[model samples]
Target: MKDLIKDVHENGVKSDYKEPKLYDVVPKEEIAEFEEVMREIIADIVSEASDVACWVYVQKYVKHKPLDDMLQEWSEASQFILAMDTWFERLMAD
Candidate 1:
């Protein structure tokens, strides 16, 4: 997972990545529409992740929650964010 993140960061996201064969069969307009919808979905996932992370941080530091419980929540949130990021990167890539 770390390697995938590093590769994405180093190579950068390829929003335009698409197969030539797909272009031959599918209309460009349809492809554009699909991509737009996908971008919107990814944006929603990122927004939700941001909200979860913020909530977890508040629970841990502001509310003075127990260390073990807070740490577990934090870890889960962090993993979720990372997974979303990786999925987005892969979606944008070939």
Candidate 2:
């Protein structure tokens, strides 16, 4: 209570106002460029994983499931991996 009263007397009665800050400090264009590069890298990873998955599926097929099934599984796995990476990034950000 004493600290609040002191703050009101020194600064102002309205204590809710906040000063803005440049938290990240990086430029918007640079951030966008970095994101584009990361997306390209992720796409390459998904493509390579899908290629390997195709070969592995062909080698393991018994009843001979369609190629679409293998592709779908690979796509889902890639997305899951990407999602996990996103979750980790969010955790680190906090």
lDDT tens per residue, model 2, 2-73: 999798999987777577543355576687777788899999988876666445445335546454454465
lDDT of 2 at 73: 57
Candidate 2's C-alpha runs over 4 A off are 1-27, 62-94
Q: Enumerate residue pairs that collide in model 1.
A: none
- Clashing residue pairs in candidate 2 (N, C-alpha, C atoms within 3 angstroms): none
- Against the reference, the lDDT scores of all candidates come to 0.66, 0.62
Task: Identify the leading candidate in terms of lDDT.
Answer: 1
Per-prediction CA RMSD (Å): 10.7, 14.8
Mark the 10 consecutive residues where model 1 has the least summed lDDT. Answer: 80-89
lDDT tens digits, residues 1-94, model 1? 6876687789985445566685687787799887788899999988888886566556645786654565575675666645544554466576
Q: The CA-based lDDT of model 2 is what?
A: 0.62
